[model samples]
Target chain A: MPAVAFTVVIALLANADIAFGQPPGGRPRPNLPPIPPKGDTTHTLTRDFVPASNTKSETAPHDNGFIQRWLALEPIRKEIQRNNILTETYIRTAFAENNFSTDFNVVPKNGRKVKVGDQRLQWHALDSKTFIFNLYNFTYAINKPPYGNIFWLVTVINCPEEIPNVRMAAGVNSGGMFWLNGEEALVLSGDRDMVVDNVVSQPLTLKKGKNIVRAAIINGPGMCTFAVRFLDENGSPVKNFTISYE
Target chain B: MKPTILTSLSILVMLATQTSAQIGQPFIHDPSTIVECDGKYYTFGTGGGGLISEDGWKWHGGAVRPGGGAAPDAMKIGDRYLVAYGATGGSSNHKGAIFTMWNKTLDPNSPDFKYSEPILVATSDGYEECDAIDPGLMLDPTTGKLWMSYGTYFGYSRMVELDPKTGGLAPGAEPVDVAIACEATAPAYHDGWYYLFATHGSCCDGPNSTYNIVVGRSKNVTGPFIDNVGRSMLEGGGKLVAATEGRLIGPGHFGRIIVEPGIEKMSLHYEADLDQGGRSVLAIRPLLWKNGWPVAGENIKAGTYVIQSERRGYALELAVDMVRMPVARWFNRSTDEPIKPVDTQKLEDVIGDWPSGNIDARIGDYMSRPHQKWNITPAPDSSGYLGAPYYKIVIEGTNRALAATADGKVITVPEFTGAPEQLWMIDQLTDGTYRIMPKQVPNSNEKLALISFGDSTPALGKFDVNSDNSKWSFRAP
Candidate 1:
């Protein structure tokens, strides 16, 4: 029994050594950079990245709700979804938690209606200027995976106005994505060989003090998993703020 | 009869020797005249006037003239020693001119030890009665130049250059405002660091006078110096140093360091009177240099004490209360689950002592044990508290106003009030528990005892005795 246990211990150590020696398998392995020294700010310095053209996923699912319906039915919808699937969740959660109906007119420019499920989620031409909405979630979760009981989400914030400098941090099992005002500000994806910073977003400089901020979160499915929080540069939650779906 | 006379003369000689040795050794009144010449020591301040110390500990009293100045700031240049005396002033231009006097030698036996007339270096130019109160001298090693600093108003201070030989201001040299306080007073210097030490808020008035010490530094002798946050000295920017924790009142008018070489100890002399109305007694405290700044003796015990004359080493201890979140409760998502507050006052293993005791101890004399253990741990959940570490211990020094520091931090109680003295010499009982007692007490009949931690959750095991020195122990309150 002692010899068997010793053999098992050796095997576990050998496995751990091999895992530590190489990067994880998945997407093409990019050039792995060295970790920065403690307190050194040079490595992994933050910057913004954005692309103009829409890049569609080669193998996207066909039954992914209204976004899927729009992609299958409308040529313009296909172009939009092909470009960014991250934005759908933001619009969906904003309407669902705010008790917004999908029956409202969405295209104020053309008087067109965009329907979600049986209701139209849109802004009317007459009420576009005064239209407002709110969102609240009873369940929130962001956690690491394998044994992850929560969700890992990726998001993008689209705003007409410039954002102010804010402290932004997110914790999750794998990683997430982010875009600010049409610009890709952060991309934290997949597991790496070593432990990494759970917070992957940088403190973004926004306009003076107040501005619009939108985040599109994509959470990996799991047991009892789902959550996203908006925080300021001081790592404080931006609470009681309003959100609009249209 | 002649034989009897001879015997009497013999006895007189021995008595004179003993008296000379013991004169300036005891605490003297203000109007101090002090000189550190060669190796001998001579000092006079407030009322007890002239006193001399050879070894810098034992003092023998000297003469106090009818009137001269409050107290003299002394320095030696080449062959002569110059002492700056505080006078009301001369012409209206410089009303606070602290007059300077020349003395060939500080030795009483020297024939050339004659005092000279005053040399007016500073005078008042304002109606607020700018008085040249506390004066400090510093020398620039790069150019071998001399500089002088003086206080004005309640919190304003300025500095200028004096000719090394003449002991007078350099021609065309103007006194620059080194720093200002909402209530700043005394200033001093060590190494190349010009320490603009001052007190803020109300002072001197009993019980009501809030006083505390704040300090800033500058690289240039004529400073546009800055504080920890880079705020300018002239702009009233400074970090706090010494302040009255509890009974310790108005600790200002700091004297130069009485450094005893070969003994890693530096003693800073200052003045403190009970409620500002009592007589000003010379207070001495052992000094610590942290990152090139002077921190007065730490772990001060609270209570009444006669400050020791010799230099003593004080351990450096800093406590910052941080908010801690429990792992189990942090992830608990039930909104209705009442948020529980953390118990911050559990001091069991932490052990450190603060210098405490009467006016003597607070003033840098003999250190005591009570003020040493006067710990202030965190007390959270107060809507009234905000910023950095929310809780704090407020203080008032001799000539400065009242101020406070972060929570869970201990302060040196600056006065000798007969309150519940927190100074103690803690001893571990046989059962592994500890009890504290005062370092020294005048009344032998007065039995000393340790106060309980109150109904607040028991936190006695948070502090432990550091292995290096038993004189100081880490304590949590």
Candidate 2:
């Protein structure tokens, strides 16, 4: 039995799964180890929204337990495909009359907020989870003509993942530009007549997760209207995504 | 033909001291007149007033005409001369005429200036905001017929016909619809095509002026003209010619045609700011024909015009001048369709019958002179009873087509199709008189022929075809 066990151990080591201890399930499985932490901070939490310092030890600002929970949602944001379709969301808070600035600090999931200054942030999922935060836009208005004649405003939105092997078109009059992730996507410009159709743009990359997108548009001479739609690998619209401008 | 220097100077004095002297008159843009008899050239343009030169070059400014029709565009038909002007009749209260003046000779030195009579061609039909003016004349070389294209009120171009001998409207022919312009002017012809060159967009809008010249061409003298890019002028379509280039301002009211050179070359005269760039001055340059169309001179020889001129013959600048008679008012049908003369009134019966009643045995044999190829021949007897004056012409170096006209005077045929109306039949009277008649003209037995001043061949006495005792080589308009 000792010889047989030694041979099994040797085989297991060679296969890169050999371990001496049993897993938490108490089954004789391969070595079970903890996933490396992505972010720096870690913390322990109980029920409710109480600060961690009020209940647990505040000895170190970094808590390994909090890091694991925060990183649990991080892998969900990874895209399956390469750089085809890109998706992103921008959140801007409304300003008061005097106009003040806003700052942001990273907050891990299930971790207590550390009050460093005037900034207020809470840990939440950034992807398809219910814990994701929403974005809003502020300070938008129209400008009159002569000086404002032939004006342009461009916007680009990113996708959660990359899409592939697809042709895309965007039509606008006034004009608009699109960008995917950090690379250039497409530019649609000029005086659009009654028959405005078939504007060619870059193909989209659709991954399993989040992608970055942006657009810029301009109004000229007369009224300005701009809208963009994407096509998939088979030149079909991707479903189940909502566009929110706040 | 003595050089009366004193009379010439007096005419100059009369020109300089004319009414409004130089102010508030309708500004004539590009004044150019072509008269055959006296071989003289006259110009009346903006600020330049009226000028005449025995030769085309050395010019002396003449007086501004009374009531003001600025730039004088003139053409001569037979013994009669006519001038068309703009700014002369563009007013709401003014039912002003086209400011037409007829002269017997183009000679500035001739004392027979009594033939210079001023008459309005026709007032606008009370339809538009502009009047009938800025006339361009083209004579169908093949048929000695006159055509006059002009501009009118309501932001459109208009046209009318004049009798070559009487200086009146042709019988049954009235003012017809041409093209339009935003702020249009200037109409000219080149090759066998009548080029309607006009200005589009805003003209006097200062630095923001959108003034530019656009052009269209048609095979018909009265056009369903198409531009270089295949847009019809009658459809308010044109391709840009001389637009506002760098430092050029208010470039409008242009005159363009192939210049008189030993070699084939085109030239355009336009008004624009010179280097001083104030007001405007007349400027000209050679134009190039590309892809079977014309582009400005600047575009060619600057590595453009991969194509070259392939047409022969000094494409003469001639206008057919038909004498306007009271009978011509009802000639043209209002529709765009070509109005055919009565079929029973074929060219043979309408014109004087040939002695042998055979066109091939008489005119065809005589017209078969050197370099004068006939495009028409007699059909075989089996084809049907041969008509008296029906002859099928096959001109040398051209497409095979039959020529049919009433009296070799006026032939009204559908432009694309070679209908019976395309036939020509000249009637000869016993008294050495001839009347060129269309196939089916309504009532008139004698119609005048519009002739051009050019040499068809040295053997042919004169380029004018309508006159008796001549066998000039004539081409289709």
Candidate 3:
């Protein structure tokens, strides 16, 4: 472990983009007035990656629910799963060409296969930095590509018994589609953040026993994350049920 | 003396020294300080969830940290525990805010465990060059004032003063920029220096993640912090503290606990562990000082041990000369005497020969008697210094405790009193032997450290870390 830690320190010292010991001697921002420790303008090291500040699978309570326990899979490109079918084509596009889409009806069938019991799915459990299943860094485990794309995240909600009017609120990165039991419950296609249940405006009704939630997340070139929760009519989190991947 | 509070260092070491670290369960991100409440250990993580351990060695998910956003930190102010966390401050949710609440206990089931309403301490408008996330809390030992450091790489890391009593911002307090080029800012104080430890580099990349810990020190809680090179932290000056462990990447979120005068431990989370399916887990490492700068020391390996007093090389024994009754042997079958359960040595059996108040703690031959045999276990639950946990020394096969009396004498108490006299901070010296000190010595500021008297008698004396009189080795009996 000491050897590994030392190697990282040395490699960081060797990287010019991330000059560790350099003094703050550079240009200033045009719009934002210079802040403290002036003379510093640009720092790519600070912009390297967005710390997944809220890495919780289940965020705090709100007027309604909580988003927790998600079993995410590695990131998969959007080309093949457009319009609910595998449409493979020659493409060298990156985040600048953020034109990507995923249809719940379409099954990409090919990516990193995850073993869920005896069944194998196109996506596998994303190695999350926290138990919350952070998707932004979750994708780095698969590949380094344009941040904006599509991901097929799968999670199983174990409802002890049948319930009526259990409102489902969700937060998705950028935007895309949401499915409950293979049925399209909501369609969000745009740029956005995973705001602990950002989709409360469009509430969802869930069935009891095993409820399958599949998120077709689309990002333009930034973080890819999502959260969902169940709530009662009063907007308090309905936590009697368990959130599981199995 | 009133029982001293259990510091974070001692509690973490209780399990760290004896067991292989179990960072896998509950699989939390950014775990909070390991705390001992109600004789058990508990810690909160991101996602409004946390973990608990009956023994420091095995942790499972069950703790509840209400209102969890990201990278939360916790500290006890008085009888209550105050937890602070970032509500939102990310690429998507840029308008970040730090929230805090206090609960008497980490357990939601406890009757005294009601959490106060969340209080807003600070906030950051995404465009303000500071994103208020990953808040780490510190209660200034010098002034008793509360301070919190919150921010991410999106902008500058800043420290905000908080009301120690209310878990809110102190009057007229404002966020002050302390560091940048990192996130999860933790403020730790040693001697006269307040060390600002933070995370640098890209995190959350599984095995590919390059997250490492860096540190800077300042004289005041708020500062113009500088690194070992004398470069300012405000200008990205930080000395490297720790980084990756081969396939393990991203060691972020710094938590410091002092076990003794010279021993400290740093706690953090590994962004990803290749050995654990790239899953994230909590990690604790010994914090060592070199030339006044703090660095991580080597990991500890567990071994069976016989704890002996350093003074005269005598093993810690029970107050009872008390006898170890012989079990029935084939040759001396007790069938003629009617078989019955045998009793361990009792205080009454040896009380007549010893002093009236404090039993004489003397050195006897290494006979490996049940009373002579001793097992040294980590008791993070016990009070200690630096980041190491104090040890619970019990007579093997019995509960009689070895305690240091107010008169600076070592004796065996009848039972485990859980008092300052019984709680001992055992420090391993340079030569591998140890100096055991009581957490408190009645009302005195001086620590009652175990020493070898001229006659090989066990007693307490003033401590000098380098003295051989206070050092004892742990041997395998």
Q: Going through the candidates in order, what is chain B's TM-score? A: 0.52, 0.50, 0.64
Tens-digit lDDT string for candidate 2 (B115-182): 44454555553322234545555555656676666663233466666666555577887766666433
Model 2 iRMSD vs. native: 47.0
Q: Judging by lDDT against the true structure, name the best candidate.
A: 3
lDDT of 3 by residue, B115-202 (tens): 8888878776543556667888888889998889887654478998999999999999988999755677889877799989887654
Candidate 3 predicts chain B with a TM-score of: 0.64
Model 1 lDDT tens row, B361-429: 121211222222233222122111000111122121121101111222222344423222222333332
Looking at model 2, give its docking quality level: incorrect
| Preferred candidate (TM-score higher): 2 or 3 | 3
lDDT at residue B188 of model 1 (Cα atoms): 51
Model 3 earns a TM-score of: 0.47
Local lDDT at B285 for model 3: 67
Q: List ranges where model 2 is wrong by over 4 Å.
A: A1-246, B1-28, B33-40, B46-48, B53-59, B63-67, B86-89, B92-96, B106-109, B125-130, B182-192, B204-208, B256-271, B298-477
Model 3 chain B lowest lDDT segment of ten: B1-10
Judging by TM-score against the true structure, name the best candidate: 3
As a whole number from 0 to 100, the lDDT of residue A205 in candidate 3 is 59
